[model samples]
Each structure stands twice: as structure tokens, then as C-alpha cells.
Target: MDAVVKKIIMEVKKGDQQAFAELVDLYKDKVYQISYRMLGNVHEAQDVSQEAFLRAYTNLDSYDMNRKFSTWLFRIATNLSIDRIRKKKPDFHLDDPVGGTEDLNYYSQIAADEELPEDKVVQYEMQEWIQNEISELPPKYRSAIILKYLEDLSLKEIGEILNLPVATVKTRIHRGREALRKRLRHS
Candidate 1:
């Protein structure tokens, strides 16, 4: 942890509410990004991110000072995301026609400045498709893949977040990649 972050965490532990807000400011985007990647819904991601911080605040006393704070917080968020995934049945699709319009897709309705070049449009569509496929993955593999690739965390860091051994993280990533490749090949 950075020294400044360490000091802020210490202050938070000492019951300084402003210190906790500072921590939220520092990590809210990251938490939301991870949640968005995992959940693939803007509203659900926001809700999950908020819930993660709330949970962290309530359980702050249980946090081990020796462990990386981000890792601990991420673990909480990841577990909550997994639980949400298991509870909800997916009723939405990215490619679904927007609000019952037969011709317009959800993506086509997204406002863009100027006109995107053909290559950029193709690349953007491909990225969106990949993200959709990722959201379909089992929670275990999805968490590993998102943490490793999207978040660019080291294997050990991912392992810590997911509460798994490094080798297990590696296996999950490998399997997740293989599944994605198979999906691409079929598509």
C-alpha cells in the first residue's frame, strides 16, 4: 500500500468517517469497473459497488491490517458479484432490440460523436461481443479471467482476491481462455 493510503486506512480504522470517504474516492471507480465487468449491467454494477463499500465499512474491524486492503475489499466485491449472478436469471441481452424496436439494437442506439471508421466500429463490436461472452462464464472462471486480464493483476494477487492458490488461479484462467476461444471458433 502507498504510505498515504496506509495513513488513510489507519485513520478509517480509528473511526474517522471522512477517512472512509477518502478511501471510497480512491477506490470507487476500480470497484465499479470490476463489478461492471463481472455483472455486465450498469445499474447492478453500481449497486454492487455501493454494497461492497457498505459491507467493508461494517466489517472494517474484522479486516486484517497485514493483508492488502484492496485485495480484501475486492474479495468482498467478487463474492457478492458471484452471489448476485447465481441468484438472477439473465433476462437481458446486449444484442436485443432496444425497447421492442425490431431494427435497432442496444448498441446502435448508443450516441457517438461523429462517425466511427469501419475498423473502429468492427473493433468496438468485437470487444462488446467478447465481454458478453465473458459474462456468460461460470462465476469461478469469470472472476479469475476478469481479475487476471481486465484488471491486470498478478496471479498471486488474483489468488488472494479469490481465496485460491496461484496454481488454481492459473488453471481457471487457462480454462476460461479455452472456453472463450471455443466460443469464438464456433461463432
Candidate 2:
């Protein structure tokens, strides 16, 4: 909604590839973050981020100037992530080995960074656990929760992004939080 972004969007609509690139540079990290949070895989996040930009470019003319561009862009990315989740088939490998009976030698073979303080290690582990639990959520709740908490968007913004009513968005967030609380409590 800033003047600078509006100008860039105008230039992009006028076929300025550099302007589009600038827009990508501005939002790539945010898009990737959303994708990564939703998919929990670096490669898939990267792919989704790229695809979001590509889709935005292709659909540029359809973008409504009256609305916030970020909302529209995020909606596209979230929908694509949801589609990817729905399409994912369980992966199985017939030849894959089962549980490891090997010794602790493999742990030493892998290189690790400098050790963190105890507090930092515990905090990092807790964050990872929470993220894993979030990943287990249904896509609707996951999208609502991530957009609200991780992206720190407003309830109305989240409703717009998910194409739901504000009341529905609030309900989703409440349900999602309750689900997360249950998961955390169980663990």
C-alpha cells in the first residue's frame, strides 16, 4: 500500500521486468517463510515461493489495485501450499532399512556447529516441537494460525487472505490455538 510498492506494481504491469524483480526481492523472504512454515520442508518452500511469484506475474493484470497487494499475494501462496498438502501421497520405499541397530559412531561422523548454551538449546528444541505440531494441523487451521501468529497479520487481513469472513477467521484461530494447546499438553 506504500507509494513505492504501488509504483513498482505499476511498472510491473507495464512490462518492466526489473520492477518485477525488485518486487520479488522485496517479498521473497516473506513468501518463503510462509511456504516453509506451511510445508516444513526447505525444498518445497523454495519451490512454492518461486511458484507464487510466477503465478503473481501471470495474474498481474487481474490484481485489484483497491486492495492490499500483500494480502492477494499471500492468499495465492497459502492456497498453493494447501493444494500441495492435499496432493501429497504418502511416500514409501520398499528397500529402505528399518530402525537403526548401529552404534553412536554415526553421530560423531556428522559435523555439528558450535554448541549452544543450555537455555538456547532448550528454546530451540521447544520451537521445533511447536512447529512440528503446527504442521500436523489441518490445512485450514494451519493457514489461519500461521498467518495470524507467524506472519503477525490482523484478523481481518487473515480473513482476506484465506477468503473467509472475519468471524470465521477468529473461530479458526481459536480452534487452532486449542488444538495446539492440546498437542503441547500431551507432549
Candidate 3:
């Protein structure tokens, strides 16, 4: 953690609104990114991110000083996104019978970029395809991948965020990545 962030957290613990606001400004993008990746919709991600911050702020007294504030905030965001996912009930069992009907505008933009070489374009497509496959993974694996890769959190941090053992976090990340790799290779 940076000294500034540490200071802000300390101040926040003492009920400083300005310090809390600063902390939120520092972490909002990261929270939003995690939410966006998990929820797959900008609007829901925004709502979840906002709700996470609000919940964190309201429960600031419960925050531990020993941990990184970003980690704490991300945990809240992840839980909120998962709750939203449960509420929506996405079907993980079905394959796309109508090939390529889903939103490919984001994928298409990357593929259309002239700056990328042919090999790079292929890699991008594969990565995008893998991301789509990951969405079909069970919730636990999906959360593991989002935290490990998209949020760049360490296994210990991920374990802390998800309230799981470090070994469990490692297993989930490995299994999730392997599943994604298999799906991409076969596709």
C-alpha cells in the first residue's frame, strides 16, 4: 500500500469524509473494472461498484488497518457482483446454438485494429473467446479468474477476499485457467 493511501485509511477510520472520498477516488476504477468483468454489463457494474463503496463507507468502522484497503474494497465489489449474478441466474449449461449472436462489438473492435499484427489479432481473438468461455464456468471459478487475472490479486489476497484458504484459491485459479485453455483450444 502507498503511504498516501495508508494515511487516508487512517483518517477514514477517524471519520474523515474527505479522506474517504480520496480513497474512493483512488480505488473506484479498479472496483469498476472488477465489477465490469464479472457482471459483463456496464450498467450493472456501475451499480455494483457504487453499492460496494457505499457499503464500505457505511461499515468503515469494521475495516481492519492491517489489510490493504483496496483488497477490502474489492472483496465487497466481488460479493456484490456475485449477488447480482445469482439474482439474474445465467445459464451455464447451454452452448450458443446460433453461432456469434452475442455481443461481438467489443471483440470486433480489437480484431479490426490495424496496428495489431496477424498473430496478435489471432491471440486477441483467442483471449476474447476464452473470456467468453470463462463466463460459462461455475461461479467459484469465474470469481477466481476475475480476481487472479483481471484484478491482478495474489493468491493470498484472493483467498482473503473470498474468505477461502490459500490452497483453495490456488486450486480454483488453476482449474479455471485450465478449463478456459481447453475451451479455447477446442474452439
Candidate 4:
């Protein structure tokens, strides 16, 4: 974490509303992306993301500064999303399969590097297809895949965020990618 972020978190822990707002602004998109990937619905993801931040704010006293703040926030967001998923009677319909638009923008930079226009189009299509396939994965696998790839978090960081062992996190990422590859191949 940056010195400024550490200072802000310390101040927020001490009840500084301005510092809390700054932290919120810094992390809101990350929280939203994780929630959105897990929930797969824009409205629900937004609500869950907001709730995660509120929960984090209320539980600031319990936060351990030794760990990354982003990981802690993501853990809250992931748990809230899981809770919401569990509460739904029909899980698939509730999930809504919203492919990640944020990821498309992130990959657009890479797509631009393709020399030929046809290759660029193919790259874009492949990315979209992969995103759709990933969204269809079971929630556990989906979360692991998103955190490892889209968020660019290390396996250890993912383990901390998801409260899993490092080996388990690596397993999930591997199996999830394999499943996605299988789905894409058969499609």
C-alpha cells in the first residue's frame, strides 16, 4: 500500500469520515467488479458492493493492517455475494450471466497490439467468448478465475481474499481454466 493510503486507512479507523470517503473512492470499482463477477447482475452487484463497503467501514476496528486492504475489502464483497447467491431459490436465473464489460476494456489494450484488423477482430471475439464461458462456471470456480486473471492477484493474495489455502486457490484456478477451455472447445 502507498503511504497516503496507509495514512488514510489509519485515519478512517480513528473515525475520520473524509478519510473513509477517500478509501471508498479508491476501492469502490474493485469491490464492484468482484461483486459483479460473482453475482452476475448489475443491480445486485451494485447493492452488494455498497453493502460490502458499509460492512468494512463498520468493522474497521477488526481490520489487520498487516494484510492488504484491497484483499480484505474483496473478502467482504465475496462473502456478501455468496450470501446473496445462497438466498436465491433459483440460482441460475438469479445469476443472470452478465459477462464482464470491465474486462473487455482491460483487454482492449492488448487487442490493439494485433497487427492485422482481422486478427484484432478475432482476438476481441475470442476474449468475449472466453468471458461468456467463464460466467457460466459454478460460482466458486468463477470467483477464483476472476480474482486470479481479471484482478491480476497472485494465488497467495487470492487465497487471503477467499480464505482458502494457497494450494486450493491454485487448484481452483487451474480447474476453472480447464473447464472454461472445455466449454469453449465444445461451443
Give the number of the best model, judged by lDDT: 1
Q: List ranges where model 2 is wrong by over 4 Å.
A: 91-123
Error of 3 at 177 (Å): 1.3
Q: lDDT per model, in order?
A: 0.88, 0.86, 0.81, 0.82
Cα RMSD of predicted structure 1: 2.6
Compare candidates 1 and 2 on lDDT and give the better one. 1
Query: Residue 87, candidate 1: how far off, in angstroms?
Result: 0.7
Q: Please provide, for model 1 over 74-145, each residue's C-alpha lDDT reduced to its tens digit, 9 standing for 90 to 100.
A: 999999998888887855875788886878987787787799999998998897888789887888899999
lDDT of 1 at 140: 89
**Of the pair 3 and 4, which is ahead by lDDT?**
4
TM-score of each: 0.84, 0.84, 0.75, 0.77
Better of 2 and 4 by lDDT: 2
Q: Of the candidates numbered 1 and 3, which has the greater TM-score value?
A: 1
Total backbone clashes of candidate 2, pairs 3 or more residues apart or in separate chains: 0
> Which of the predicted structures, 2 or 3, would earn the higher lDDT when compared with the native?
2
The stretch of ten residues in a row with the least summed lDDT in candidate 2 is: 90-99
Give lDDT tens digits, candidate 3, residues 1-187: 5788888877877777887888788989999988877877667889999999999999887988777878788899989989999998554322324356664343443344357788987997776566567677777899999888888888999998999999999899889888887776755
